[model samples]
Target: MTTLVYLETHDGELTNGGLGLLSKAASLGGGDVAGVVLGSGVRDAAASAGAFGASTVYVVEDEALAAPLPQPRVDALEAVVKESGAENVFLPASVLAADVAAGLAARLDAGLNWDLTDLRLEDGELVGLRPALGDTVLVDVGWTSTPRLALVRSGTFDPVESGGTAEVKEVAASFQEFSTQARLVDHLQEESSGPSIEDADVIVAGGRGLGGPDGFSICEELAAALGGAVAATRAVVDAGWYPYAAQVGQTGKTVSPRLYIALGISGAIQHKVGMQGSGTIVAVNKDPNAPIFDFADLGVVGDLTQIAPKLTELLRARK
Candidate 1:
């Protein structure tokens, strides 16, 4: 089987999620593992895919695809898939990638299994594992048609370098008038310091027990001390206490940081499903009976207002 992993780059670099997926796709070891990069000036970034396990890197560089729009990418990806005859297509979940994946599925009349957390080859067939029933259970999913498409959840895997090189191949793409009809008007990025939640190695997350919008300062200070990023629960984002981009839960971004510290979080199932994959989970809450304690590797029954500052100060002093 020939597998194609869509490599998405941002700010002239391949996204960690996309590289991680490419690494995982290479590990399956059943077929030729190739990565397709679609964007203007993405050739340089595509070269790094070889180190992450791509045996071949397909580059589709077009000026019209400069912006982070989805339709042009769909067109480019379709051309690459057709030319390469890729039987399995994998993409890391992102706002634009999700749109392009859906568009490609419709264009090719293929089956798409999205929100997949894991995938494996069994009996020479690909199987996708996804959360079902509100993420309460894991169910196996597969495509009945050729060119099986799968969208992997963000932070589901980490990139590992294989010290290999890829043969770079350039491909041409044709865009439909309708696909190029929409033009990007403007792009506004969220101004943030430190790592983004999805890419952060350490994340200090806040929840409703934080009391008010201003309470995020506590998480910010601690996260800063640890050289990490601040995250929030759906409750805090819904209450306008934090930006929706920083929310981590069932409806929000999934993060698998090396260390996840929760402040005043109740550990609801919705929140658990997102960050449960963290390497180490630490919860700080005043209530001993809080559900967060059940799964936290280290549980501290204390007031975050009192503990957070002290922890930050101690970390600063040690630094």
Candidate 2:
């Protein structure tokens, strides 16, 4: 089987999620693993995929793809898929990627399995693992047709450098007239000081137990002291206590950081499904029987208003 990974680039650099998926495809060890980069002036980023284990990198650099639109990307990817004869296509879930994946699937008449958390080869067939029943169970999923498509959750895998080189192949850019009709007017980047929650090694998340929007100050202080990013629960975001981008839950983004600290979180099943992949989980809440304590590596029953400030001070002092 030949696998093609869609390498998404941001700010002229390949995203970690895309590189991680490329690394995983290489580790699967079933066939030739290649990557497709679609954008203007992305040759350097395309070549960099070699470090993550892509043996072949397909480049479709065109002025039409200068904007982060889905249709042009779908066109570029379709050309590469036909030229490369890739039987399987993998994409890391993102706003643009999700749209491109759906468009490509429809164009190719292929089966797409979305929200997959894990994948493995069993008896020479690929199997995808999907969470069901509010993430309480994992079910196996597969495609019945050729040229299978899959969209995996973010932060599901870590990229490993293989110390290898890739053969860069350039593909001709051809787009449908309708694909280029849309024009990008304005692009705004979110202003943030620290790493995003998806890329942060450590995350400190706040919840409704914080009592109000002002209570997130403790979370911010602690997160800053630890050199981590601040996150929030759906309840806090829905209540207008936090930004929706910082929310973590079933309807939000999934993250797998090295350390996850929950402050005043009740650990609903919706929230647990988002960060269950963290390496170490620590929960601090006033309720001794809070659901967060059930799976936390360390549980502290205390008032976050009092304990968080002390913890932040201790962490700053140690630094």
Candidate 3:
């Protein structure tokens, strides 16, 4: 049985969350732990993937692979999937991964599982766990067909060192024109680089209940105090109160932090779907009826305007 994980990377750094998926997929089967990496940073990316248990790394290089649209990488991945005879495909529950997974599943005629909270192999059959109907219920997914595919949520599993060297092979191809409708007219990357939100030690998230843009100041204060990053809910981002990059929900980044502190967020399933797996979760909301309280390990009921500033001050004093 062979399972392949699409390794995610940016610039020259491999994604922190992708390593965890490699570790999880490796535990499920005993075939080649292959990785599909496309970009100029393939060598470093493949080396790091090896520490996470990858045995084979296929490098597909092309400028168009990073040519604004990711359809080329999806095509490259599909070609590799067919040639490698991969039985399973795993990817991080990220925007790019989600897009690539959708395309790959459609191209391969395989089932695509999204944002899996739990995964296991029972008697050579694969199954996944995820929230259903807006976090109101849990669903168990079983693939009845060949070459199973899943997008595992970040932070659900730990990445461990499993000493192995990945054999790097090159695939030459010009991937574009497949999805020609979407053109790459704009290109931008993050100016500041540090820890990714999903890999942070702490995350302080703000929401619309924060009242206004000023509400994020307190979140920043707390995050700075804790050496973490600031996150925001979909409501805040949709309303233009926060940047899209800061959004932490179904439409934003999927994060798994050591400690996630949510301020003024109502526990919408879309928001929780991406961030329910923190090591410790704390929430502050004015309404005790807020759904976020249900999954939070610690809850504080109060207006963030009054509560957040005080907490930030107290934390700073202690530090």
Report the Cα lDDT for residue 296, model 3: 99
Using Cα atoms with residue i matched to residue i, what is each candidate's TM-score against the true structure? 0.97, 0.96, 0.87
Candidate 1 lDDT over residue span 194-273, tens digit each: 99999899999999989999999999999999999999999999999999999897788899999999999999998999
The list of candidate 2 runs beyond 4 A from truth reads none
Worst 10 residues of 2 by lDDT: 247-256
lDDT of 3 at 299: 97
Residue 319 error, candidate 1, Å: 2.8
Give the candidate order by descending TM-score: 1, 2, 3
RMSD of 1: 1.1
Pull out the clashing pairs in model 1: none
Tell me the tens digit of each residue's lDDT in model 3 across 176-224.
Answer: 5655456678777766344557668899999888888887888888888
Off by over 4 Å in 3: 174-183, 190-194
lDDT of 2 by residue, 1-319 (tens): 8999999998899999999999999999989999999999999999999999999999999999999999999999999999999999999998899999999999999999998888899999999999888888999999999799999987788899998999999999789999999999999878888889999999999999899999999999999998899999999999999999998878787888899999999999999988988999999999999999999999999999999999999998898
C-alpha lDDT score of every prediction, in listed order: 0.93, 0.93, 0.80
How far does residue 171 in candidate 2 sit from its true spot (Å)? 0.7
